[model samples]
Target: MRSFVRVLLGLALVFAGTSHLTFARQEFRAQVPELVPIDEDTTVLASGVAEIGLGSALVLASRRRRLVGTVVALFFVAVFPGNIAQWLNRRDGFGLDSDEKRIARLFGQPLLVAAALWSTRGGSRQRS
Candidate 1:
C-alpha cells in the first residue's frame, strides 16, 4: 500500500511539475500570490523545478523517503498561500473560476500534505 501510494504521489508530482513548465504554465501563474515579490512566471518556473526534484526524490531515494515526504509535505504547505491568493484575488484560472471550487481546493491542499506524509515515512512501513 505504501509503495503504491508513494509511487502514485511521485508520478502525480512529476506530471504536475511538467505541466507547470509547459501546458499549465499560464494557468499556474494565476495562483501566484500578489504579495510574492518575484515575477509570477518566475515563481511558476521555480516551483516547477522544485516539484520535479521532490518527485524524483520520492521515487528514487528510498533511504531518504521520510525526508522526501517531509519536504514534499512542506512544499504543499508552502504553496498554500498561493491558493489563498487565488481565492481572495478572485483570479480565475485552471478552470477554478467558481468560488466553491476554489474553496474546495483550498481545503484539498492539506489532503495532499497528509498523503505525502502517510505514504512515505509518517507511519507506514518503508517499502521500496
Candidate 2:
C-alpha cells in the first residue's frame, strides 16, 4: 500500500510538473520579460523537461528511495525561488487567477515538499 501511494504521488508530481512547462513558458514570458533577456525559450523548455524527468525518476527509482527523496527535496528547494518571485512581484500572468489563490499556491510549496518527503520515507519503511 505504501509503495502504491508513493508511485501515485510521484506520478502526480510528474504530471503536474510536466503540465506546467508550457504554462510557465507562456506566463513567465508575459509576467517577467527579463527571462528572455537571459536566454531564449530553450533554457525554459530545458528546465521544464528536467522537472518532468526528475519526477519520473523519483517514481521509478523505488529501490533507492532515500536518494529519490533527497532529489525531490532538493528539486522543491531549487524551485522555491520562482515561487517567491511570483509572490513578491505579483506576476499576475502566472495563471494563479487571484491574489488569494496565488498566496495559497506560494505557501503550498513547503507542504508539497513535505508530502514528497513523507511519501518517500513511508515507502522506504514499508520495504524494510
Candidate 3:
C-alpha cells in the first residue's frame, strides 16, 4: 500500500512537471504577465525538469529513498518563490485570475509542499 501511494504520488509529480516543462514558456507567461520581465519561462522550465528528475528518482530504489525525498523537498522549497511572485503580482497570466483568486492560488504552494513532504516521509518509513 505504501509503495502504491508513493508511485501514485511520483506519477502525479511527473505529470505536473512534464506539463510545466512543455508549456513553461507560454502558459506561465500567459498566466502572469509581469513574469515576462523576470524571465519566468526559463526558470519554470528548469524547475519542471528538476521535478521530473526527482520524481523519477523517488521510485527507483529503497536504498536511495531518503536522498530522493530530500531532493524533492528541496525542490518544493525552491519553487515556492515563484508561487509568491505570482501572488504578489496578482496578474491573470496562466489562466488564473489576477485578483481575489490570487489568494486561493497562493495557498496552493504550501499545500503542495506539505504533500511532497508527507509523501517523502511516508515512503521512507519501514513497512510492517
Estimated TM-score for each candidate: 0.93, 0.74, 0.72
Q: What are the Cα lDDT values of the candidates? A: 0.90, 0.66, 0.64
Q: Write the per-residue lDDT of candidate 2 for residues 7-121, one digit (tens) a residue.
A: 7767877766665576456664333334434563554566567667777876787567766777777877776776666666667765676677678886878876776677677
Query: Alpha-carbon error at 118 in model 2, in Å?
Result: 0.9
Error of 1 at 52 (Å): 0.8
Off by over 4 Å in 2: 20-24, 28-37, 123-128
| Best lDDT among the predictions, by candidate number | 1
Q: What digit string (tens of lDDT, one per residue) describes model 3 on residues 19-123?
A: 887854566544433534557677667667777777777666466665666677677677666666666766565656756676777677676665555655653
Looking at candidate 2, what is the lDDT of residue 63?
68
lDDT of 1 by residue, 1-128 (tens): 87788888888899899999999999999999988999999999999999998888888877778888999999999999999999998889988998998999999999999999988864455543
For every candidate in turn, the CA RMSD to the true structure comes to 2.1, 3.5, 3.8
Error of 3 at 115 (Å): 2.2
